[model samples]
Target: MKENIIALHQKNIAKGAEHLFLDKGFNLTSISDISETSGYSRRTIYKYFESKEEILYYLIIEGLDHLVQSIGDAIDSEQNFLKRYEAICACMLFYYENYAISAQSVNRFQSNAPLNMTTSVERIFALGVKINEYLSIWIEQGKEEGILKESLDVMPTVYILSTNLNALFELVTTKGTYLFASLHMTKEQFLSYGYTMNLNSLLKEPTK
Candidate 1:
């Protein structure tokens, strides 16, 4: 029961951090803000987190864990390598489109690398490691199945995919309308165009 209570307190603090960080922007938010927003005492917050950066790291990990779960489920449901890859893209877009604010926050963090707190930088690197592992596993599977070309360098391909996806999300969350509105493209439509190009370039043709 004591452990259960501690878990609940930790979760409450994390929830508060998420709300305040998103609402006030992480840079502008303070512990007082979280205390007022979450109704958790400063002592309680400190009990669960070493600092504000720790709280933000918790939120980032929470978001990444959720995305990994969704992507895992989507990829598992598909038998075809290419289809699994497509499901990966779909799950990614679903999360971004639904959580555009978080996406925007991530974009800001990426572009403002100098402003990154130690905890946030470590957390992002941790997430990058997870992404690289996932990309490596899936791309290797595709190679063995002959759906990805045999000559593909897995790391380079992974880097290319990750880099472009970040750029795509940044654009869609910011300056999307200005960059794409002239072409009468909605964000989803624009994403589809990007996704299609990636697939065409990455996937090997089925044997006749």
Candidate 2:
């Protein structure tokens, strides 16, 4: 069937694109390259995607969905706020360690893409707000249980902590990976650092 053939071609193109994006990044990859790698003709490639930017957009969406799912799965069983936070960190580290090229490609896409750039930025900002809302709920629960600081503004604190974790991971992944494996310039290090910092900042009780 024509539909079946199209589906197969689409799958192959996606696979090839993912490989090239990770290995060569967005700017370096070309339509011809995708055609050769995917065993599809240039015409077929154009039929599916107008340009490399479109391809990058699909990859970004796919990667983010995977990342969100990974984090969701990691925390499904944990009830404690600190433990859940650690689970999130664990998921992020796992992605970085096992899918470094894909992860890096995603970061590059977010930072460099021009088409729909403002829209993409807005989407990310909305996602951050949603994440902060969840963090607020989690912290409020912790306060009710007499575990977290009572005076903490649930939403603001969540936003601050989440921002800090993201920045720290970015630093570790970009510059710290080789400074002794223990230093966690890698994903694992970032996760470990997250746990430590969460325990220090969120889990610690205020003294009377």
Candidate 3:
């Protein structure tokens, strides 16, 4: 089925806003900047988004939607439960790598305008909360398969994993890849090493 006119317009405006954010960081980008990038007049932007804050929140929702779908695809493609964890890790990396331009939008919006995450935004992003659902399914499946520690406290553990993703990716995307490149290691090698390190912490010994 086709999306409604309002949703389609909001998506177009959000896509245009993303371009402006990429050219100039989110904090520096203004409504006029988006209007310039989108070729949509300021009046048109305001028709979909009341302010830059709403635009940032919309981008956050889009980011989360992408992440949850990536995780789902990863889980579906991997047969081994342990390998599925690695796939999920790769999915996380892909999200940041693909959408690095939006990090400032998410981080700054959460920091400077914390109160703007009201019930309306929550209702809007309620489905995007599937990131946790996918993680929970993986953890639960891993525990049953004896690939993850049965005693793993899924919530706190996943919370740490989820919360750290942005900072970790920022390090890699911003400078850590260069650190590895200087050592003659590719970004893939660096990411693989990081995944190994995560497994060493999260995975259980292969039971005979």
Candidate 4:
């Protein structure tokens, strides 16, 4: 079927782009590179994506969706709040360590060429809204259970928590570098450091 072919092309393009990104990063990989690596004609590549940036955007979008889903599953599998938070930390740490390149690309994907395209911009915004909704639901559950502070508003709290967690992870893993390095720490090391900070921040009272 035509749809199946398109799907196959899209998957190939994604894999090709990811390979190039890991090797050369977003700024270096071109449409031609994607086409050649994917073994699709440039015209065929364009049939699936208007531009290379569109491909990158979709890649990042789908990657984050998978990340969010994993986190949701991890939290759902746990009973206690602390254990759930631990599971959440574990999930994030997994991505931070294993998929660091893709994660970093997401921040860049927002500012890149595809994001400026109206249709792609709308899709990115829609995905953000969905991601925020997931974060809000997670926080709502935490709040309802009295683990998260009672006065927290979902949207702002989710934004704050997500941003802070990213920064905290960056601080630990980045060492002294300005850019967060995906290579510096093992997953266990990063998780231990980041989770300690996370659990400490969540506490209403500090233990001596």
Candidate 5:
């Protein structure tokens, strides 16, 4: 069918563009680069995607989909709040380790790119909200179970966890080598310690 063929072309274009974006980064990769890499004309590329940012937007969506699924699976696999929280942290590290380009693409889009307010952008924000909601649910469950501090405000706890986790991953991704050299700790060690500290901060201290 014609629609199927269009989908195929779009897939091909996105595949090629993903490679270029990973290799050269989103900001440096151009329409011409995408065209040449995809073996599609610039006009054809335009027919599928309105702009480079739109293409990046779709890639971010794909990445976030994988992340959300991983977190969901992690949560579903364990009933213990602390176990589930650790699993979620592991899932986040897995995402950054495996999907480095998509991870970087997300950072770049959020920090530097101007908001275009496309439907794709909306989807990206929705996925972000979904992620936050996941964290909020986990935090609330912990509080109910007496695993997390009862006084911890759910939204503020979510905000701190999300912001600090992102910062930790971004730091490890961008300056991992420097950190290793300066701090004498591997990226894995750093992240493990960071996650442990974050977890401890929320946990209710056992009654003596």
Candidate 6:
């Protein structure tokens, strides 16, 4: 009963913080804002979370959990390596579009290492490793099926795919409107081209 109450408080705090972070961004949102939004006093908030960054970390963990599950399900849904790859891409696009704040949390942490690392940070890193492992498994399966180039080094291929895909997602999230307007392209067109281009690079014979 005691544990359940604590979990409840933490959940409420996370919900409120996510809203404020989405509305005003992590850097701009304040503890006072979280307290007011959550209807929890400042003392109660502090008891639950040491800092605002910790709250953001909580959200990141939750988001990455969902992402991992989505990617796993996508891979399981398709026997064809190419189709599985496409499904993974679609899942990432959906995640970034709907969970913008969580996406931003990941990007921010990746670019800037936190000064004082905590257990939450460790978990975040572990989740990242898990994501890379999923990609590695997908690549290995593709190679075994003779779908991906036999000569492809798994880690390097995973690195390229992960890095480039993140870059593409970041570009769309940050500058999609401006870029699409200037290029006379829609977001769907841009992303479709990006996804296909990335997919083609790994095929034993590039897609025509």
Leading candidate by TM-score: 6
Q: Which residue pairs does candidate 2 place in steric collision?
A: 176-185
Q: Pick the candidate with the highest lDDT.
A: 6
- TM-score pick, better of 1 and 3: 3
Q: Mind giving the per-residue lDDT tens digits that candidate 4 earns over 86-149?
A: 7776666567667666577656544545436567557656666766776687777777877677
> Residue 17: error of model 4 in Å?
1.6
State how far residue 111 of model 2 sits from its true place (Å): 7.2
List the pairs of residues colliding in candidate 5.
none
Tens-digit per-residue lDDT, 1-208, candidate 1: 9999987887788787777666778889899889988898888789888888777666666666667777767656756876777688876776676554445555545464576457666776667577677878888988898878898999999878867876777677778879687989887788878777776677787331
Residues 31-54, model 5: lDDT tens digits? 999999999999999999888877
Q: Which ten residues in a row have the lowest lDDT in candidate 4?
A: 199-208
Q: Which pairs clash inside model 4?
A: none
Q: 195 in model 6: Cα distance from truth in Å?
A: 0.2
Give TM per candidate: 0.78, 0.68, 0.82, 0.76, 0.84, 0.87
Question: How does candidate 1 score on lDDT?
Answer: 0.74
Error of 4 at 176 (Å): 9.6
Per-residue lDDT tens digits for candidate 6, residues 14-79, read 999998998898889999999999999999999999999899898888888888888888776755
After TM-score superposition, the amount by which residue 114's alpha carbon in candidate 6 deviates from its true location, in angstroms, is: 5.5
lDDT of 5: 0.82
The list of candidate 2 runs beyond 4 A from truth reads 1-8, 74-78, 98-102, 105-136, 155-159, 175-177, 181-191, 206-208
- What is each predicted model's overall lDDT from 0 to 1? 0.74, 0.65, 0.73, 0.71, 0.82, 0.85
Q: Which ranges of candidate 5 are over 4 A from the true structure? A: 1-5, 107-114, 181-184, 206-208
Q: Which 10 residues in a row give candidate 2 its minimum summed lDDT?
A: 124-133
Task: Flag regions of model 4 displaced more than 4 Å.
Answer: 98-101, 108-119, 171-190, 205-208
Q: Locate the minimum summed-lDDT window of 10 residues in model 5.
A: 104-113
Pick by lDDT: 2 or 4, better one: 4
Residue 143 displacement (Å), model 3: 1.5
Tens digit of lDDT per residue, candidate 3, span 47-144? 88888878877777677677778898877774787678777887887777776554454444334555656654774446445677778888888788
Pairs of colliding residues, candidate 3: none
